[model samples]
Each structure stands twice: as C-alpha cells, then as structure tokens.
Target: MPDFDFTALRRFPDVEADNLFAYDASDHLILDEAADDLHAAAPGEVVVIGDRYGALTLGALALHDAADIRTHQDSYTGELALQNNAAATGVTGFRSLDLGEELLTGSRVVLMQMPKSLSELDEVAETIARFADPSVTVFAGGRLKHMSIAMNEVLGRHFGDVRASLGRQKSRVIRARDPRPSAESAWPQRAYLDELGLWVVAHGAAFAGPKLDLGTRELLRHLDEMNPDARTAVDLGCGTGLLATALARTRPELAVLATDTSAAAVASTRATAEANEVAITVRRDDGLSQQPDACADLVLLNPPFHTGSTVHAGVALRLFEEAARVLKPGGELWTVYNSHLTYRPALYRIVGGTRQVSRTPKFTVTVSTAR
Candidate 1:
C-alpha cells in the first residue's frame, strides 16, 4: 500500500467554502475497511460509486494499486472534481462510468459513499447485486449522523449478509455480501401527480423522487404568470423536470431547457418531459454554466439549500448567480426555497429586483427580474 494523502484532495469546480470539503472521515474509513478486498481483487474488479470527488477512486488507485477502476459519480461537478484531482495527484487507471452493468459487471469489490436517500441506496445496492460477481463485497460508508438502520435494511434486500464496522471519526462502514439479485430494477420510478396533471419520473437519486415537493408545488402555481411573453425558459436545477414539462405543456411555443448537475436528475427530467409529450432540452450541467449569457427569457428554480448533508445556502446562492447570468435583461427568475433561507436580499443583489410571489409557513416563492 502506498502513502495516500486524502487531505490533499480538492473539490474544485464544485462549491468550495471554508466549511465545505472534498473528502470526509467516511472516505478514509471506507478505504480502510475495504483495504484487504481492494488489494486482493483482480484487475478491473474494483468499482466505486458515489465518490464525491476522487477520494475513493484515487485512494484505491494509489494505495491499493487497484487497476482499471470504474467509478460512478452522480454529480457532474463530482465527476469534474475527480478528473481535476486525479490530474493533480498524478493518479490514473480509474474510469468514470454510469450506474449500470458496464460499471458493475465482474466487480468483486465495491466501495461506496452511502447516499442520503434510501431509494438511491437501494438502487445502487440492487444494481451491484444484479451485476457484480456473486462473491462481491460492498463497503458502504457514511457519517454516523447520516447512517440509519433503514440503510442496512435496504442493502439487506439485495445482499443476504450485512454487517457494520466500528465507528471511526464519526464515520462507519457497512459490509455486505452474498448477493440476492432481484429480477428487475425498481429505479426510474414514476407517479402521476393528479393535482398538477403531470407524470413525474425519477431515478432513485433524483430530488423528491417522482413526487411534487412542496416548494416546487408552490412555484408551479405561479408558472402561468412567469414572463408571459417569454420565448425561452430554463428549468435550472430541474428535478424530475416538473417545472420544465409543465412550462412546455402549457406554453407549447416556448423553448424549454432543463439543466441539473446530477445525472440522475437530468435523466429523470428527460424521462418526465418525454412521458408528458413535451419537448424539453435536458442537459447535465453545473447550474446554467453551459448556457450562453442573457440567453434565457425566464428561469425557474427550486434551489436546494443543502450541499450534501450540510445545511449551506452557498449552493442556492451559486444557482441564483448562474440564473442571473443566463437571463436576459428584464427576464424573470422564479425561485422557490425554504422560508428560513431568506434569499430575497441575496436575489436582489445577485439577480435583480426581487418580489415575493407567494409565501407559506414552510416555503417561499419569489420572482427576480434580471437587472
């Protein structure tokens, strides 16, 4: 094993702040717990999922001499960060892949950063069980505060044996083996939101997962009033493409684009749009970075308040700035967020003149016009 410096990793291209981090105790603990399996596995037998940056992938490559490592990172930002970190560390051999057979097939050892969502965990576990070698061992780690008994139960559904390791630095790893592959994958779930008259489709990692979140529901109420003459609209951070599909369905002439950082979210949005027979251009993007400046007449956002498990407003603020950058002068940016965030002042400063569209006890919807 080589001496690997986890602290040297950086979350570049992702939101970086004094408090936000590229790696965590969980990453080290997972690597440590799975060290034997990782080292003993044959070339191309190790697969990493949910690597926030390149911590697990790079650590496995550098420390275990793991070869032909295949990894899946849901966030596009995480993928870019991994690329940047690998280049900086001069670590090679790992390939970023989507969550499917190609990434998991013949995988004897799997290292994962446990997702916060149970559905996401289930999806990953099912995929591993279905595709990985029968003798595969999974090391799924997360901060103790985020780990729940439900996660064990979720993994147990796909793996016959599951056990937990002792906590280290407030992180713990769950080891699972004896694959119990299911006949079908329960992912890419769908539900009809009768109230909204829309069919929501979601992959496990998609936010709110095939359901209309309260914040989005509030914003949906005002979609008809958003830039009435707008010809081009963007559903920034479109989860399940509810807003994008709704906008397209209501205004067929509008050119709708849905952009999200999460691959699952982008896929879900595309599926949602297709299911509704609405034409929405879906892109896996870091906010509206790929869109040209002043190109959008309206941008709808239900900005997430959290960056991973941390309750940070930085992610939402960054999206606000992106929405502002992509909006034409006088274009409207309709945003829905938790009321406690009080993003009005920030929106006014970052986007333009802002006004409350609607407010509830828990959520607030506001529209900001580009200055």
Candidate 2:
C-alpha cells in the first residue's frame, strides 16, 4: 500500500469555479476514521457510494490495498471524475454502478458520503441493508453542518444499531451495523401532487424528491404560453421529470425528452413520467449531449444552482450552452432560476432574445429565443 495524495484530485465538468471547492473535509475524514475498519475488510469486500471525486475509492485502493471496490456515484460528472483520477493515479479494479443489488451484494464494508436529503439516505440504507452481505458495516460521513439526527433515524429504519463518531474538523461519521433485510424501502417513492393532480415518482438520490420545487412550480405556470405546436420539446436537466411530465400532460401532441446527468435523476424522471401516464424519452446524459443539434423546437430548463454543496453557476451555464445548441433556429428556451443569480444576461448571450416571462420574490422565469 502507498500513501495517497488528496490534493491531486480535481472536479472537472462538475464545478471548478472560484468560491467553490472540488473536495471537502468530510471526504478525507471518512477514509481516515474508517482506516482500521477498511484495512480489516477483504480486498474485494469494500464498497463506496457518493465519493465526490475519487477520494474514498482511490484512497482505499492506494492506502489499504483494497482491490476491486464497487462504487456508486449518482452524478455522471462525479463518476467521470473518479475515472479520470483513477487513470491519472494508475489505480485499477474499481467498478462504478448505479445503486442496486449488483453494487452492494456480498460487500462487507460500505463507505459513503452522507447525502443532504434524508430520503436519499433512506434509499441508500435500505438498498445496502437488503442487498449487501448480512454482516456489512456502513460508515456514512458528512459535514457536521449538514448532518442531522434524522439521518441516524433513517439509518435506524434499515439497520438495527447506529452510532456516531466524535466530530473532527467539523465533520463526523455515522456507523450502522446489523442490517434489517426485511425493512421496506422508501425509494422510488410515489407521491400525489394535489395542486397539479399529478403523481410524481422519485428515487432517493433524485433532487427535490417527488415534490415541485418553487422554481419549477414558477416555470410550470408559464408552460401554456410556450410553443405548444412545436413537435419536439426537451426537459434539460430534468430532475424528477417534473417539467417534462407537465409539458407532456399539457400538450399531448409534443414529443418530450427528459435528460439529466445523474443516473438517479434519469431513473427518477423515467419513473415520474410513467407514474404520471405521460410519454417521454428519458436519458442519463451530460446536459443535452445525447440530443442531436437543433433537434428541439422548445426546451425547458430549471438549472441547478449547486455542485455538491457549493452554490456555483458552472452547471447552470453549461446547461444553458447545451440547451442553446439543442434548440433549432427560432426555437425557444424557457428557464427558471434564482432571481439573484441573474441568469438573464447569460441566457441572452447563450440562447438569444431573452425576455422575462415571470418573476417572483425568489425565482425569475425567462424565455430566450434561438437566433
């Protein structure tokens, strides 16, 4: 085993802008705190989930001689970053997978970066407990600021015993043991939205979790004014397929495509679309990378404001660029964003002919036409 260098890691295609960082204190603390436990696990028995870059997976490989570790990263960019880091460092034998039986089966030790959402944590704990080896031990770490007693409660729902570590560097790790295999999973959860009369389905890692985000809610109000006669529409960065489903239901003649970078988001969108009885083509893609150029006449976007925990605009800007490329000449790109982010200028520059469709206290809705 060799000493690993954390500074060499990068978060390309994720967020590398100023005022935001690639890795965090929790990433290092998780590996360091679980060093002894990880060392004791067999080479092939370690699993990592939510590793932001390659910190946990690569660290285990380089420092503990843990080989063939199975990992699941919800974000496509995070997975790519892990691959790039592994290639750069010459580490091998780690497998990247979606959260499922294949990723967890027979694993004895699981390392996790605690998710910000309690539903996400619930899904991870349930899947790990139900699919992994009965004796598997889980170490979930996160910054103390984000950590909550609710996380432990979620873990307790799936595992028999849960314990916490003393905070170090404002980060802490929660350990859960004694899996409860029969626990009912709360993931791929289905909830009915009374306001829209729509059923939204979401996997744990999906953003907003089957609920209408305020921005998307604001955008939905203006969907009727969009190019209704357009043949093709896209829900770019469609988290939970709320926009796509709304569009499909409102305009049944339109062919809608829902694309997201997160595997979980893609799955959730697909589920949401199906649950709502709406037809949509859903794909796990980096922005609109899988869509042909100028193929869409209308594109709907509710771009995310954060990369991990940092409020960064890189993702929103990238999505805007991709939406511009995906929309045909004279097509329209409808967007809703935080009012303070002031995405109007970027929309005008990237998509052209920007106009404010609606604005509320928290969000601003804009329509940009493709020149």
- Model 2 stretches astray by more than 4 angstroms: none
Candidate 1 segments whose C-alpha is farther than 4 A from its true place: none
Q: Give candidate 2's total backbone clashes.
A: 0
TM-score of each: 0.98, 0.95
**Candidate 1: 10-residue stretch with minimal lDDT:** 1-10
Candidates' lDDT values, in order? 0.92, 0.87
TM-score of 1: 0.98
lDDT of 1 by residue, 324-351 (tens): 8999999999998888887999999999
Residue 163 in model 2: shift from native, Å? 1.7
* Whole-model alpha-carbon lDDT for candidate 1: 0.92
Q: Model 1 Cα displacement at 111 (Å)? A: 0.2
lDDT of 2 by residue, 264-350 (tens): 889989888888888899988767767789999999988888877777788899999998998999999999888888789989999
